[model samples]
Target chain A: MSREAADGRAGTTVGPGPGTGTGQGTGTRGRTAVAPARARHLRTRLGLIVLGSLLVAVVGTVVLVDQLFGRAQRASLVDLLERDLQRVQALVAAGTLGADFVEQGAGGVRLQFVSNAGVVLLAPDATDPIPLAPTPVRSVTGERAELVGSAAWLLPSGLEIGTIRMALDVTEADADRATLRLSLLFAGGLLALVAGALAWVLVSGALRPLADLARQAVAVDPARPRLARYRGPEDEVAELARALNVALEAIAERQQAERDALAEVAHELAAPLTVVAGELRQLASAHPDDPRVRAAREAADELLHTSQDLLTLARGELDRAPDLSVVDLAAVARGVVDAYPGVTFATDGADGRVFAQPDRLRQVARNLVRNAVQAAGAERVRVAVEGGAEVRLRVEDDGPGMTPEALARVFDRYVSGRAGGVGVGLTVARRIVASFDGRIEARSEPGRGTVFEVTLPGWSSQVEGESAEA
Target chain B: MLVVEDDARLRGLVREALEATGHRVTAVGTGGDALLRAVDGGIDLVLLDLNLPDVDGIEVARRLHADGEVPIVMLTARGDVASRVEGLYAGAADYVTKPFELQELLARVHVRLRERGAGEGAIERAGLRLQTDVRTLWAGDAQVTLPEREAELLRLLLTHPGRVFSREDLEARLYGDDLPDSNTVEVFVYQLRRRIRALGVADPIRTVRGKGYTVL
Candidate 1:
């Protein structure tokens, strides 16, 4: 509407200019008109209902007063005029038709008495130059004749006399009508303001609890949110809060149950695993000369070690994650390489370090190395680190890389290529990485080798010096 | 030798293993038999189970030690450190957990016998010889190295001086707790008799009758 107004205004002045009216002024006004119109449209539905009702009440009051006062004032004036007519009739009957007598008999009214010949018989205080006309008389219809509310009478001698004309003064009544209109308008406006203030108080009071609940929900941490039930009402808003609280509690309980089960199972398995490993190690030592026995014993030992790794992973998932220390990635890599020499392990980026639990990182390296060795020939594994704000550790093998489907599912629990395992190694590794807010990704093509990239944040100031100790 | 175990299968297996190594082997399923033989006065060695049906193995071991200087090697379920420590503290000479290799048990048995031999003497046999008070032994003067358990057996034989000691007599000397069944002491003696022969000497410890033994 503003745009249209501006365009209409400009069209008259500019005589069809190229861009002056159409672009800048019209665009600004066009946008400006939208906000207030939207505001007004909203207001009319609510604001106007209250304002219009108040206005109707005020106007109705004025109209009612006018009808009542106007009628009452007119009746009073007619009564006074009737009295004047009666007094003039008596005076005429008595033959006191003198002007001085008429002046003394009429009270404050400008009265005139005329004969049937249309000549004024008596006049009192008639200052105006225009002569007063007798009230119109009809010989046949003689009930009452009034010209502007005057009465005329026919005397006994057939001379029509006692024609009285009086006027009502309404200066005070006019002033009172004006005062009534002003007061009604003032009272209506005051009522509207009070209604607006009342509406504001009611709306805000109604929404205060909801606003508090909304603030709490916004501040709720997604990872560890604890929503409490609203116990105040069985009403709709309270019911919504109650339902949300129930859902949050269910989620928290399930997560806690999973953690507890994982911890309990891991603890149960550890003792048995330790015993089995000890037995196997002893058997191998006893029959050092028997290669077949040694091989069997070594296989059993590996299975035991794998079980330990699974336990470690389960424990880490249950918030038993160890406090981290800064560890030299190069040193840990070299240690794993030395321990398992059959695998030709090489490390790059010896200068790089990372802040992590040393034992856990060792487990991660061992798990990745074990997986790589299983897929590729153990001799072709390589570990590389790239330094930055985050340290990236890459373990790659020349083994057949996985299909995209396998890569996607690799981190899922109980997924493995290794024969006769719980198949939890990769899953555990991923969980450990996630605990540190790090990420592990596997890239592979069918014929090419697989590469696992793990990136973790570098050391904070406290962990900086710990790399040397590790 | 005396075998003390609650399980019948394990008792039979232990008796067979020890008997195959060539001693009169006696096996009992309770600590009561061990206590009986311990009072009878001539058992040579006790292979006691730390987990017993009749008495607490450690308590039985302590009682047997109170009765006499009987060498006891405790056999238990393996790697149960608490029980093993308890057994040792209760006067058992050695503690070994179960599923143990027979060879490890035999090695412990031999060490206990040598320690006993160095402690006492005056025992002689076709495979073992003892000189009492000097606490030394000569198996044909080649100086056989016997572990404490075997030496203790020869020493007991020498103390009786060729009186043809019965399995019960040897059991009483070795296990001071309740005796194993009469055959348990026979098994350790057979093993002792064979290893002594391997050292080229007459076995010093002899089996007599239900009456007992004396060195002639």
Candidate 2:
């Protein structure tokens, strides 16, 4: 259901329901939809950015070119007008007057010339002076002259031959400007399309790494512990990947540790439970009067304890220390040693005392000693301690030592050198030690002896306040 | 009768409980030692804790199963579905997740024993075959007919062929919950011996020194 929801949210086209189509609704198809939809959305955003940038660039270039061309064409039209006016003035100065020149013009300039003495010289029509009412009337006196609008300028002849007036309208210039405007618009539109295409390529390239990282994030599984290759500077995405990898590593380590712990816990609990069931059955049936019933019951209790330890471990609950007091290490070791007469045991410590729950400490100490005895198969075991702000206790045995692997996980829950131990002992011991902010270490090699060391900070000092006698 | 456990108090309690249940038991702490003892000692069944100090409980179960079809009941502290399934797959006949009720364990023990009994023939030494489940006996093809007391005595002897049954064993099987006296079993055994000898077997039941009687 969650997978279906994820697929739906990604906006991939839904096909026929499961097992409904010959090929469309297969596993591969269903899986393919999600990523493609996600990719499509990402691509859409990239396309938009590329297209927008292209539009702005193309439009800006077209506007700039149109303004420059318009100004240049305007300037050239004015120059042509000035040169045509000079030619007309020269023709008048040469005294070359013809009826044809007044009737029809040689050039495409409409003209009417008049004398300053109130005499009309020439006109396309014999209208009187055509009154320079709308156009400017200037005396062509200087060699160089300027006109404000369409104006007639008088040359400096003093003949009073008057000015030849002509006006030119730029109808062809307007048509050419219109054509240039259309071409510029068309080119700008085309350029925008091309730019958009180019931008799509560049932007997608920039986001390619991010897209790949997303794919990796989707695929990575903590249980499998596949590390992803991260690239880029100290960017947010890179940091995210690094953080994810760290979290993944932790999860992988924890999962592995749990699996190993479970295996050991199973081993530890099975033996006695088997024995208890076996013995109980036999006693109930064939040996109701047998005195050995008592011993069988005791074994049953141990199985129960082992089960409890496993339960605690599974729940991640730490066991509580019961007998709170100052415990003399030597005395506790002596008692355990004396209890197991078949196994010789000794203690060598700086007479350090530890403030702790006595029973819990004893449990820790006993488990260590017992583990050593079981490994060594020796009749003798030794306990040693060192004093200071931190107190260290060591249990050594002349037993077959441990392999490196065993030593590494010796403190793990349900680990046992011998076959029948409920593996929870060492696990419980480690938990107890940790509760007191202490450390436990083991040193061993195969076929030699093994030593267990435990160190607790200020243990001896704390012990002085909580005396054993009290 | 070996008790394998690491907890001192729990071991003591278990021993007490089994004693109360009226069986002899020896307690050990680990799986390796338990296996050794199981091999050497004639233990009828093993109440195994899956979490042992040395060997994994499933491995122990496999070994114990391979050694013989000894009934193994796993005690798991973890009550997860996977663990129980795994235990069964690994050869545990039954699983009891802790902390189990004492009565439940006793009941399981009874069930395992009873199931074991159903698998084997009731009559041990004699060619007579008996079915404990249906309570029927056959000598050859036909059903064997015998006096009630004689049939009862034969039934007990058949279940344990090599086992030597004292006079007290007969009283426990024949008598109700209470015992009249130790001598009562002697009389019954003697009469049972006579009835068998009279059938021309010439005393299939043998008397041992100190111990009472044997089918061998």
Candidate 3:
């Protein structure tokens, strides 16, 4: 079976552009936006918690105050009724229970005397008399009723006096409690609203520095890297900003050092190879028919090619941006195929335009074809370009394919199937393709042919127009 | 032409190659020397290396460009795209990375000189002659008048012979910065080859697979 058919195209797939997954925190803006949103969410949650606890406390306090005040007021009302009863008893004993007594008892209290045979003796005031039961003790009864306290006494003439019940009006106390309830509810609700507003304002104001730090962090560009110095107070937010700035500084320094070292190494390696190649070319020209000279020239060329590959590998995916220009992939493939006349390389595509550096794209195409040719052995290598939303270049070789283990790590550095292969070609190719917002993948099966596919974002006229406007 | 390179051996080879191609060459080891020699009024072109001992080569190219319109070609070991773009922005006419074929470098120099209209001559290869001044192609005893672009393409192909020119290279040469389309070069090559074949001579232009058209 074909590699693609057997494997169902299971290969390493890399997406276009920089960040692929959501919430990966890849870009500076992504990270900055996430930080503020999370902080605000946390602050709002904490504020609601505080407001909830405050409301609970207020409700508890109102209930407790209402209970204590109700008990004290009721007790005082009972005492007043007791004092009135004593006065009434004295009047009865002095035989002065007449119109004057009635007039004095009309102050929010009603007095009534009942006989033991269920007949009323004397009823003071125009209010209803209190219900009396024959009992030899003082008692408070009729909660929220006009008659609140009652008592029974025995006369000095050895005649059994009926119970003397004094009724006290509770309308004023009831009205006061209703007013207290309304005022407490109104005050508690207003306090809750004010507390919530206050918390919102304070929390947002406190988090202003964090928002500022986020904005600053977003504005930090790697191309022109500037430290995110926080000028605010030395609080947690400021400290966080300072720490980020320190980390950025350290990272920038390390990257700068790495770039410098790579450039130095590339220059050092390229210089000697250039000198050697130039000398070899001169020698070859001087002795045009010398086989030894021709061999030396070939060796020099191979050495130069390998050194260039090494430089590309060492440079990796950093140090430079691809020189974006409109390039025809078919043309680049043709150029690479021209170098290998012995191989049966076929290219089929129309005009596949992409934005890329010409030289780098040429290097990538050349490397892939070279690898394919070597892998195909004596068979043919086919390079086909399909252009649509994305331009896909597929290089298929008809030879013994790789094992699953080899296919898994085919693009890795220093991992090669062929003897004496430096193994940096595919690694460099992948890096170059990725730099162009493209990717490279390989699919193969043991004893079958291998196919390496490179996909790049296609160039559009609309994008060209937009860029030209910019 | 004035060549600026820090390395002695590469400079010697470059000097020999240019002299072999029948061009007067002046070699300098420093950017300062290059600047001094560039303004001496007899220099037709400047071949500058990016790395110099005394002053930076990009600075020299900028100064030379500021002085006049003498086309500058940067010769450097730095093959990165950024360096190439930087050299161009610094006013270099072309860029050639190190370990490049001597024939390619010579071809680029000849093209630059031809674009400047410094020398008018006929380039001959494989019994085909391209006269730059009169814009004519002579295939053995048969001759044909050519269009301006066709003559320019023929001249470039004859100058380089077997060197491959990508579409971008050809477009840049033909239209300067105003690119027309991707297939423009292919069409021009096809028309030129047809016109030469109509002159009762065999077509000398061969398409280098995947690279470009070349006359071998």
On TM-score, the candidate that comes out on top is: 3
Enumerate residue pairs that collide in model 3: A334-B209, A334-B210, A334-B211, A335-B210, A335-B211
- Candidate 1 regions with alpha-carbon error over 4 angstroms: A1-247, A277-323, A333-350, A366-382, A395-453, A463-470, B1-216
DockQ, computed on Cα atoms, for candidate 1: 0.01
- lDDT, candidate 2, A1-470, per-residue tens: 12233222212121122221112222344555576467657766777777777777767776787778877776765666556666666665655655577678555445667665655666764462344533433222233222212334344463544556654444555567778877877877777677776767765665566676666655553224556677765677687778878877787678668856864565455445555654564565466676677456545655555554565455443322221234566666666666445655444446556555444566677677667766765465666666666777777676777776766656554456677776777766666665555666666666656767777654434322111212
Q: What is the interface RMSD of each candidate, in Å?
A: 24.6, 23.4, 10.2
Of 1 and 3, the candidate ranking higher by DockQ: 3
Q: TM-score-based ranking, best first?
A: 3, 1, 2
Per-model lDDT: 0.58, 0.58, 0.71
Task: Give one clash count per candidate, in the order shown.
Answer: 79, 81, 5
Determine the iRMS, in angstroms, of model 3: 10.2
Highest lDDT model number: 3
Instruction: State residue A203's C-alpha deviation in candidate 1, in Å.
Output: 5.2
Cα lDDT tens digits, model 3, A4-109, are 3835854655434343211112345457768778768867886787788778877887788788887777777767777778777766655666646655677667
Kindly indicate the candidate among 1 and 2 with the higher DockQ.
Answer: 2
User: What CAPRI grade goes to candidate 3?
Assistant: incorrect
What shift in Å separates residue A338 of candidate 2 from its native position after superposition? 47
lDDT by residue for model 1 over A1-470, one digit each (tens)?
12233122211111112221112223334555454444344434555566667667767876787778767765765666567666766666566655676566433345566555666655544443113434422111133223233565546454655455654344455557668667866876788767865655554454445555554554443334567535344566687677777877887677567645765665445334434544555566777898987777667656655755555443332222222334666677667666566665444453456555455676677788878878887787776676656777778787877776666566656677657757777666765665555667676666767777677765432221212212
Error of 1 at A16 (Å): 64
